[model samples]
Target chain A: MRIYIYRRFERFWHWMQALLVMLLMLTGFEVHGSYTFFGYENAVHYHQIFAIAYLILVVFAIFWHLVTGEWRQYLPTLQNIRAQLDYYLFGIFRNAPHPTRKTALSKLNPLQRIVYFGFKVLVIPVMGLSGILYLFYRYPQQYETLPFGFVGIKSIAYWHTAGAFVLVAFLIAHLYLITTGTTIFSNLKAMITGYEEVTDHHPTSDSQKQEEVVI
Target chain B: MKRIFLGLLLLGIFAAILIPSLFKEPYRPPLLSQLREKYHKKASKSADHSKFLPLQKPFTRPQEVTEACISCHNQRHIEVMKSSHWNWERLEYVTGKGIRAIGKKNILNNFCIGIASNEAACNKCHIGFGFKDASFDFQNPLNVDCLSCHDLSNTYLKASGGAGMPDPSVNLNIVAQSVGRPTRNNCGTCHFFGGGGNNVKHGDLEMALFDTEREIDVHMGTDGVDLSCVDCHTAKNHQMLGKVYSLSSMNRDRVQCEQCHTDKPHQQTILNRHGIKVACQTCHIPTYAKVNPTKMEWDWSTAGNLKNGEPYEEKDSLGMVAYTSLKGTFTWARNVKPEYLWFNGTATHVLLGEPINPTQVVKINELFGSYRDPEAKIIPVKIHRAVQPYDKKYNYLVQPKTYSVTKGDSGFWNDFDWQKAIQAGMQHLGLPYSGDYGFVKTEMTWPINHMVAPKSQALSCVECHSRENSRLAALTDFYLPARDRNYWIDHIGKGLIIFTIIAVILHTLLRIYHSTKNQARRDV
Candidate 1:
């Protein structure tokens, strides 16, 4: 059976965010002088531009999540969490069944919920706030910057770079987890077409089975 | 609905970048009117002294002009006497005692040491007449030099050691008639040439200031504002507005940018906020000694070195005098980036009789301020380093007679005898100088406040925040990000991150082994 897992708005937000985040990391690391690709000045310029766009996307995505009642999909639970962890670790390698089923109401498994929840609630907010502060730290007007605040530029830069590394680590892990689906391309295809396949004899309700064709 | 939100966001981003321009064009009065008012006010206030019958005489002595000027302006001579230019002694308050009088006359500087035995050569910049020896009259009002401050003819040439009077060949009648308001040339004559020649003392101030472009100095640009010396430094009763490092006056509020500008001089709020702790000069004057090279290092120990039977000199790549047998060895540089420091108006001077530490480099004049001081701001400075003669036996810096070229004079340059020069200098100052002398390392600091570049040329954010070759690399008081790193914290953080990944991988391998056994049993 095939099931519609992600809405159009959700798919749009996901792909746009991924693209912007990649662009931000590229330009941001250049600004940090990690390895210069675009020159330092150009890197800073592009990073600021992408950051503003990412902020706009975040606001719209937040609104969409709230209106569609999709925020609950990330609400974590301990029930079957260990089973899910076992499935990812031991069960999948031994050709065992997945611990939890995917539905319109539950897009993420237990561990996914915890990781994504922390990213959205903690890491993303931290990155956004710190990036904003760094942008305006030397807000130049009439060729002079505003005096420094209580927090120095160094503190702001450290927090922003730390957040970026967290995001980078999450991205690497997210990439690896995509290949652990029913088929290597199954999760990727679902994100693109909004339809994910299930085993033929999977015990899904008639109403739940019919939900795949709605989109 | 989503499309509408995206459209609104795009509009907001555009507004964010565009709104600043609308508020940027600040309302400044037309520069034409400001210039006219400034020059007109200065020109109209001075009574035409040229028409006065008392001044129309062939003055043989420069003192006669002073005498004639004081005849009409009775209290002018009295006011001039109290100024640092005339007295060469400032009311020292940096130590907070306020009782001591300290100035160039008594301060032991790195460039030329002290003015004790070298008064004839040093006092070419002095503002009086016939101050040849200790018995020179300070109370005589006729000795006040009016022409040095108000020479409009620009032809008045003060012979280097001619006791504060212009050379006899320079017609005093013409000079007396041409006296008017002080221009840049009038003040820069001594200031730009201090420590010997142009670009010697203050790196930011040089002959380049006379007709430099806007890129060199925005305020004093020849093609732009063309401001004279009196424009910002408006004098009242012969006392100039700005304080000098040599004078060590704490009256910093006498003149500032606030005279013509508002506190909120920026269009952006953040820049205005930065204005509180960062001085205007910090950003504006990015580099000093832009056009002409300024002397940075002077090694007096190398003086009296001769290649053969005659004195020899060496030149650097830029043709600047590098070494000379007469004086010392010097190193010069142009477009030099100034060292940053925390400066709170006051500069501490090492007085003439102060004790010396031979083991360490002595600061001839130390500029004191720190990040913790509220009154202090980060400012740019030119650090002039040197090796000078000091009395090793007395544990004090020695003053050597430098430029008395007379046959019988005991000047070091006149006849290369350190003992005679030291004896002559000690006798003149009436201070004890032990016969033994040795070279001691010394440094002098001058705060850079001129040669302001345009706004576009100001330092960028990354200049001072980089890992290598950062402008503030030498600054150790506070840790700067990107430039400074805590190794332990970084290592520990990375170690935890690595440990987490390793633990995850190990736990998964163990789970796989257990699950394979269970699957094998189920299949059997």
Candidate 2:
């Protein structure tokens, strides 16, 4: 049976962020002198534009998550996380049952919760702060008055580039994980239509018991 | 959820519409035109120089004109005597070498070498009555030739070999009566023709700057603001506000563009930030030697060649002096792009009697700066290279007597004898010169600060930002984006990306194979 899981704002935020991040990477790598697609000046110009768009999307996403109490979906938990890892590594090939189930209230499995929480708390903040510093490092009026001194742009640029690589690797893995659901295109369609096909288990089953424990 | 999505959609729409307008180019004020208007009124002089009775008197000797000028302006002679123009040296605190008097008199250059024993010929540009030898008195105020820079009639010409005296053909009375503030013509007479010819020493400075279109130079162009040399090089107590690094070793007395155009002149903050590390001339002066060809290379080893025991000269296809027995073989070029270097307005010169490595190309004067120096900026320069004589045994540069008044003398220009010329030149300076002599390659750098092109012709960002033939490719001290990248990071980062993609493909294929097997078993 299909049930509505992703809200309208959640799907919108997800797709918008994906598009913006892809554009940032395309222009950012060109700016780094890695094979040029857009010219250097145009790349810098567009990179700044997309970066602002991404920041805006992030702000809206943060507000929506907090106001709707949807932030609890990503709270890290160690329960069944090892089973989820084993399921992806070997159990998926044997058609074994999933360690965790998806629902309207608890959308993220234990492993997904930990990964998303770490990304939100660590990676995004680093990329955002470093990107802002890179944009305004040469702003003359603010340069002298800044509390912290920067000898050069070398360290900031390296950190931003490293974060970009991490984001790209995460994207590759995320894209592959979407296909590991009940069907090849089930999760993709669920994100788009907000309806995921979940198995109807008995109310007092072990999975339900585990879901109660998680909640 | 639907209401929140709609709100975000509206916000995104507003941002998309408003962002472009926020970045629209702002109106930039015409600061340059306003500056021109302010300085344009100073052209009209208050006093009519021709009405002075002292200047009207017929002056026979150039010294008599100086005496006539000193009669009215009595204390002005003291300021003139103290200047580098009359003294030809200044007390400069050179780094690593305590206070030393350095100037054109002591400094050696690749072109025309030094003026040790050849003062009679080289002193043609000196603002003095008689600097024929080492015995020329520096204490005498009468010897200061005031008319060389003050003559407005353009008739006060210096004799070619008369030791800085006025030419006999010049009507000194007319020149003295017409004396006014120094114009481009006055400064160009000596500065534009430093190495015995127009634009020979300084590629960016030449006779073309006396009167040119705005395209050649925005400031000195007669059609434009028409600023005189003194407008920027403002003088106080007869000491000018600028010094060439060829003779100067200190960073003081600099004439900066920021004096008028503020450091943050650009409307865009991005462009203004470049001013910190890039000099104005680096972009404005795209090319030097715009109108006339400048000497690029001189080979003294080929100077002794003559046709039938008579000194002769050869001309290149462009009619430039290619070879002259009196001087040397020279290579000339026009519209040449300047090479860039980091400079902090300070330099170290290869002094006289200083030992040099004969095997390597020695820098006559080394410009001191680096990417790490906060005060340093990238500047455009014209490098004049030459192969000149040096003492082989002593491992030091030896001055040669290239010119002499007496015919068939031991000077290099007359008798063409290297041994005798070296001996005479060394004896004049009281420096020991080994009899053994050989030619050594040397380089002299002159900063190109003039012949500034219009704003439209300034260098674009791609010139230095691209990986292909970047202008700043030689300066590898710091990392510049688009032109530089860390090799290890790039390799490792790319490797991980490729590895992730391969693993994803392998895992997906394995899952697909297992699923097909399970589906077949369920159907059976």
Candidate 3:
């Protein structure tokens, strides 16, 4: 049965963030001299512009998540986590029934919660901060009249590029995991249309009860 | 709910960065005008020197103007006469041996060789009258040319081969009437034209300084601070501060930027800590000769190339004189990166009689500094390289008479006779010449203190500390990251990170394996 899971704002934020992140990675890797698609200078300009837009998106999305209490979707829990791990590693290949149920609440089962939380709290902030510092490192107003030393731009570039690699790694894992849903297109369609097909009808957890009120 | 707090935190950070910047004041150089006014009291409440009776007369010789200047300002000529400008020399205090009188008049340089037999052409920059030969009087107070330094009209033209006088065509009366405080043009007439042309001797200085954009030179730029020469080289009693690298060390006259800007110019402590070991110019002036090309290499051995027995010249891609039959092959470059060196405010000059190693390329003057020295700072210097004649037997660099272009004489440029020119130059200095001379490579290092670019245009960190193509690649005295990396440390650091990541992944895999087995057991 089709159930309303992802909200309108949640789907919108996801798609927008996807587009911005992809654009950023494209121009960013070009700037990092991975392979030139756009020229380096143009890549840097586009990357900087996309970075600002991504930051604004983050601001609005954070507020939206708080107002609607959709942020609880990523709060990790031990319940059924071992069963979910067992399903991914062994039970899934043996054609066993899935151990965890996907409902309106608890969208990310345990592993996704930890990875997404770390990305949002740690990796993304590092990328944003290092990128912004590189943009204004030799800012005229800051250093022209009074030249002073800080951590050098070389170190900053190194950190920003490192953070980009982490994001790329996360993206690769995320793309592969999207196919591990009930069907290959199920997870992607749910993200796009704010609806998912589920077998269960009864609400089980307190989070499920809370999500029922919102729906 | 937690996301609202996170949103507020990010907003606060953005506000913290933007709000203070709106009210921050621009930098203002510390003013010493009030202190200077108290110490060196001005002669008048706007007293005009043009109305003075002695200056009102029609002047013929520059000496006549000097006579009028000293009549009222009696102590001025005496102070100038005692100065190195008028004397052309000073007692060497930094010498390892006992104090000896050394000056530009006695020095032998690779450019236009020396002042001995070529005094007529060279005396155009001299601050005295009739320095045409060794016998020229130095005791005459009236011979001091005041108009060269104090000329407000900017019409005073010191012609080559004019014996320390302004070219005769200039109306001396108007020059005398127009006396005022010296400007950059007044000082740069000789300085900018040193080594015969603009941007020749000192690569950092050029005619571009007269009207520059802020990008080329922030301090002297028209749109910027627009500072004159004397602003930094402050003169007290006509004795200006700063000693040229080619000249003897004038330690007392060295001007530090801290005199105007405080010791801690920056708000950040990281920069203030570096101020002790780094010069203001080291970071400020990333490159030299930004506006026009400066001579980088001069090969006098290739000189005397003639097109049908007549000297010819050729221009390069940048339109700089690439090949001159009279002066030889010259390589000029603009936006040239300077070599870094440790300088502890002292330099050891190679005087006229000093012995040199004829087998090796000699440093005409060596700046004395090292990492070990507590007072030393890494400074930027333009190392002017040239191939000039050296006395092989005597093991000394020769001062060839290069500019004396008489019809049948010993000038090197006129006849290309190295023996005659070297002999004449040595004889004038009262030193014995071996008559055997060979072309030897020589270098003179001039500290780059001008043409400060805006900080945005200043060199990025990688330009100095990168693995390849770094400006300071040749600086082996210190350790820098990427430029000088410890292999073991790098490997260990990377190895630790990689090992930790692999261990975490292995631990996660093992946990998943154990958990799956337990789940299967429960189901069975």
Candidate 4:
């Protein structure tokens, strides 16, 4: 039975962030001199545009998460984390059932919650801060007064590049994990349409328990 | 609902990408050129010099003309006498080497060596009368050849090998009467012909800049702004506002681009930021010696090679002197790309009698700065390399007497003998020279400050930002994007990405195989 899981705003934010991150990576790597795609100047220009868009999206998403109390979705828990790891490591090949169940109230598995929490608090913030420093490395003194007193862009650039690599790795793993749902396209469909088909057996009791725990 | 979100996302992406590119960059006013025009108009002299009775008198000697100039403008020679142009040396505070008097008189160069024993010939451009030897009095006001610089007449010529005297053929009275503001012709008389030939020493400064078009030089172009040499090199108390790093040490009196154009001259904020670290000449003067070829190499070791016991000259296909039996072999290049380095406007010169490593290429003058120096900017320079004589035993460069007024003298060109030339030169300077001498490689750098092309010819970002053949490839002290990257991060990052892809593929296959096996079992 299909049930509403991701809200309208949540789905929109997810897709938009995905598109912006992809664009940032494409242009950012080009600016890094990894390869010539958009040309150096154009790549820097587009990268800055995408970065600003992403920052705006982040501000809105942070506000939305706080107001709607969807921030709890990324609150990490140890419950069934070992089982989640086991499921990916050994159980899935043996046709074993998933260790943690997903519901409207507790939408993420223990492992997903931890990974997503870290990605939100750690990886994204690091990327954002380093990128901001890099962008304003040498702003015109006439236009804006920046407090940053960085001697060189060496460390900031390296950290930003390293964060980009990590983000790309996470993206590849996340894309693969989408196929690990009950059906191959189920999670993908869920993200797109704001719904997922949950098995009907004891759904009311499971959701009630999840709601209590989440609250 | 999904379709609406997808369409909106696509539209937003397209708009974001297209909006910036669609709008052209705002037009920036040509403020620099406008300022140049203003200065060019202001450079006009108020007084017609020919009307003065003192200048109209018949003058036989160049010194007599100086006496005539001081007769009216009495105190002007005081300012002229105090200048480095009169003394040919200045007291400079060299880094690590305490306050030392350094200039063309004492400094060693890779080119025609030094002026100690070759003054009679070399002092043809010295801006004084009778600077033939060490005995020339610096205190004499009449010795100051004011007509060399102040002469508006094109006919004022310094006699070759006459020790800075005006040529006898030049009508001194005419030159004296025509004395006014110096033109491109006046400055180019000495500067354009450095190292005994046109465009030989400084590759960027050549005869071509005297009346060239905007393509060759924007500032000195007669058809353009028509600015004289004194426009940028503004003089106060006869001390000009510029320093040649080859002859100067301190950061003072530099004629910066910011003197006319502000530090933030570019339209884009990014380019303005770049201006802090990159000099204007680094981008604007992309290539120098645009018209005439300049000497790149001079090998004095191959000198004394006589063709039928007579010094003969050989020319290349371009008619540039390739070899002369008197001065040895030379290589010339036109439209040469400049090498880049960080300079904070200070320099350290290799003075005479200084010990040098004979095996290594000696830097006659080393420009001081690095990437970490906040005051430093990357500047383009033309490095003139040469193989010149040095004392093999004492390990010091030997100054050779390369010229003489009369034949059969001890000068290198006259006698074609290095021993006699070195002996005469060292004895003149009162320095010890080992009887034995051998040629050692040396280098001298001339900062390219002229022949600025039109704005459109400025180097684009990719020219120095790319991985291969970057103009700043030699300057590897700091990390430059596109030109530099961390090796381990790149390799490991790529490795992890590939490893993750392979693992994902393997995991997917395993899951598929297991699921298919279970389905087959259920069907059976």
Candidate 5:
């Protein structure tokens, strides 16, 4: 059974992105005066700079995904989703079997593929655009021109604040599911050093599925 | 390898943000200071150009220059002081009229009629030694002396340690708020900007506050004469004072714009990129210049010029005449919009707005001493009064308004009760009076119904009844009533250290809590 469907680069990007996002969310809220860890102004400046870097990384990731054709793997499908949900809910707890197999080509669990794809294409982009708009959302001193009189300042501030709320919600969900990985640190270590082992009893790869004589 | 690279990238980022910033102190936070005591005092105190007030510091000025004009243009100073121009000085204000406060030093002199605090006000009518002084830093210096051209001699100090008269032949000053010069920089000293790299915020005064050819935010910038700021904003040494017999009650316009703009064309209705019809002054409204109008505060040195035994009439050698008339009349139009007029009584940071219509009127029953009220008048009574935040003079400002005071021998309350006074003032002004500012103050009503009433008046007992916008000076945010900033900074540092220790303890507790909770759940 194949053990490495997630490439070294993809795993590296995933965990690096996760850690940075956690740091960012923690610091970003502190900056907004929600709470304070670092001083408020310092947190704000750090959040802004890190946000800029994250945006640059997104650009790089998007280009990499496009070049690698890995983008196609996340195209949403209803196929096998119901069965996959049932396998995790009942079969896996009963020790019957995992309904899905990990392969060199398809590494993501069905739920993760759909959710991650949605986040990358929709949620993150909204956060990025709204945050960028917020940073420069000030009236030019020389021009002093504004689209909306005073409302312009307030509106952008609202949008950025709303986006931050959404991002924070996502972080809470992501952190709570750390136990879902094969072992406590297995998924985390795979992201860092780029490898994870699979037991023979579990169906490990689609190549093995293809080699099955009857199916 | 990737983690190593990530570490290097983080290091690079830290260096980018920290190193240069540390060296240059590039991270200067916005100055959180609002107008404080030193500034408030400066704004409240004004220079007496008309009277002989001692200069704050020694600089070159001629005492006798304008003496000749007193003979020819008698009473020019007195007349000028009564005008809207003198409004900066709060002349004729029952407490103070016409005058408003801007910065303590940078008094926004309303030189142009029909245009409040516009560029022409700065470069045209307002004149001083800086216009001729080569060393003046136009950006910061409150250089324009109110008396520059008004003096009969038309005298000015020259760079070469010489005092010379403006060419008497020249007719400086705008020709009565009419058609004049069109060339750019005409009012650029406060408006048109771009001279000497003197950037302007809005389209009010040009770059220079005084002669700032470069910029208002910067003082002492470098620029050449070919690009001289005065090219368009040409002021004539007209040797005259404010407009006579106008409600405005300030100096006649100075710095003739016609020399450059020979033609007069009003608004040709057209739309700009924003799809709004335009006028040259629409975006360039005079409000910018007028916002902090400081020119009107009375120079304490010239406060009460009493000529007790003499008659009210005085004549200058020029066959000019003057009177001690205290009648203040005003017209409401484009330039003379409703605004607060601070009196030279006491300097306070508080702002009190005027109503479009003043609810009362007062006549000069007498000047220079004991007088009687000829008739009953509505007065504004104080309801509630509070001291200014972080009083700069750091002295007690006892407001005997909302709170109480003992009356002499009269067991009954004082007849001039503050609560009654404000109610009466509010009633007269047709305003719903509430709030208990005690000291009673009122205003004589104006002629018209201004839409934005409370937004435009002087600080009165009745007006401050409502509270809004809780702001504090920057100093108050930190520990203060202490010595210099260093001690306060140390206090903040200690707070940070305590906070860090608490954070570590809290984090350890949280980790323990979560782990135990997880184990209990698993056991169950």
Candidate 6:
């Protein structure tokens, strides 16, 4: 069986999207007065425009994911979840065996499915909502008979800020996990070049049980 | 292909440059009023004493003028002679005792401190004559002499050292009227500061000028009705009002409310008949400005507010707002007075309403002056800060002991659940939390109020409750400064540090979870 899970456009979009996101985070923090890099005013201006670009890219990415059936990859499943856990925790460390193998037909292991599923479903939406709120917070006129006492710009501001911290954490973890691929640079290279070198033959249980190192 | 590549490269550069500058904020320093600038720079030069006294060689005052002043003010001849004014040509006071910068012959006044730190307040009055800019002898050249007040007809000056003049108070008030009158503006020069407190400016002089005639802003007010300059400035102290930059002879004690008005008897009789016990000033005229006349009222006729075919409880038979004995939004006008007014407090974002312990994550930019957003509204734009890490609010106890679960009768806090109680406590502190709002499975609310309850440890009264009991001190992450902007800024900076810890912790937890999984795999 064979499958082309990610189209060329999908891979190109993903790599570029990731690069832009990292750039945005760096500049967004500086503009938020976390530190000075490109000077305060410059940082702030860049953050605003970059945020717009991010929003535009997100729209395109969402459309692409929907039209090309790529969004299905993120739909989560719990099949053999325990085996996947065991594979990571115990199996891989001993170089014993991979309980679930990667294939063109099924790219992710169970654990990868669950984690990436969560990233798409929960983390991305939360950050996106907060960021959009932060940007468009100016519109609502903010007036009433007694100036709505219980709510304020503060609560909204805190939400956006808290959201920013979560995004920063996600980026850090994502960067670290990227290095855990076949080679230190393999995942990064695949993202850039749209091609990954997979083991030519599928490793069979009989071969692995006999301690064979199948090329 | 090469040309196409070059075109794309140029386009990329153009896009990068255009994106940031398009959203940039323009740089303009804070606006300083012309008068304020003049008050700082050529302050004494514009105070032409030559107009009061002619430019002449040192000559004694007109004999009759001295006799004229002596007629009523018979006491201080010897005191005047011994004063630095008497030794005007002598090398004393200027470099010796007055101006702190020189330390000698600088006997400007009773001010013991310099202008920079505000140890004393003579800088408000009796400032240096032609200070350093004139390149004259600061030690003993010019004196704000006794003659500057008493010599009414003739004036004298010694370009280098001395000058003499005599004047009457009324004439000076008249002449000084044109060249910056000694009115509320001059009073603000000193009284706006508490002379020597930590918070520098007293009144919010930075407040934008108000032109509206009426607003029922019951919580604030300034000048109106009988509450005029006389209400506060009831008396004049030193008969001689000092030079423009110098301190005035303001009789502070005489300015108290009791100093002038005899307690009115008619107010009590009316109150007795009505069975009400309250000060007439309390309800009738809420602020200083309302008590003073000539203050205009906003239009109530156009407001169209009426009740039962009448103009409501606001007016009496005379069509005046009964309580104020005038028309229009008298209540809001009263609130404008700085003395009687109070900030709604909530409007200022003073109350910490999110992340239960707002002090945990302070605004990093606020302390370092780093927070600003070019994309946001320009009304006092700033990088609104939350607290950061390394703060002392880790264990702050929050309140609001109950919360609603959802819209149904079942969700109300009628039943006592431990989860509800804990959630309530967190809510009071403005901590981060998620719960069911009506029609929604997941809704989050950050802290709206914070109260770190005192540890149950017994203590001396002064230990925990000493001076820490402000009306909302328990709820506040930052204290309102008694005197300094920097103090307030620093306090806010310190309070928001706790959140940085949360960020760091979250970051570490994720890394740890992944690392642990990776470690476990290798061990197998």
Pick the TM-score winner.
4
Candidate 1 per-residue lDDT, tens place, B63-171, comes to: 8999889888899998999888888886667654355788767777778777887877788788988777777788999888999888888888888787676777788
Provide the RMSD of all predictions against the true structure, rounded to 1 decimal: 5.1, 3.9, 9.1, 3.8, 19.9, 28.2
Instruction: Give me the displacement of residue B77 in model 4, in angstroms.
Output: 0.4
For model 4 the interface RMSD, in Å, equals 4.0
Q: What Cα-based lDDT does every candidate model obtain? A: 0.77, 0.85, 0.75, 0.86, 0.35, 0.35
Predicted structure 5, TM vs. truth: 0.40
Predictions' DockQ, in order? 0.17, 0.42, 0.04, 0.41, 0.11, 0.04
Worst 10 residues of 6 chain B by lDDT: B443-452
The ten-residue window of minimal lDDT in model 4 chain A covers: A139-148
Model 3 DockQ class: incorrect
lDDT of 6 by residue, A109-201 (tens): 777788778877776776677666555443222242222333343554454555556665566556655654555576666666655554444
Regions of candidate 4 where Cα sits further than 4 Å from its true position:
A94-97, A139-151, A201-215, B1-27, B31-44
CAPRI quality band, candidate 1: incorrect
- How much does candidate 6 score in TM-score? 0.36
- What lDDT is obtained when candidate 4 is compared to the true structure? 0.86
Off by over 4 Å in 1: A37-69, A94-97, A128-153, A200-215, B1-47, B96-99, B246-277, B306-312, B486-524
Candidate 3 — which residues are off by over 4 angstroms? A1-215, B1-45, B95-98, B496-524
TM-score of each: 0.85, 0.90, 0.66, 0.92, 0.40, 0.36
TM-score of chain B of each: 0.88, 0.92, 0.87, 0.92, 0.21, 0.23
Task: Compute the lDDT of residue A43 as modeled in candidate 6.
Answer: 59
- Expressed as tens digits, the lDDT of each residue in B420-439 for candidate 3 is 87888788788888878888
Off by over 4 Å in 2: A77-99, A138-147, A179-184, A197-215, B1-25, B31-42, B312-319, B507-524
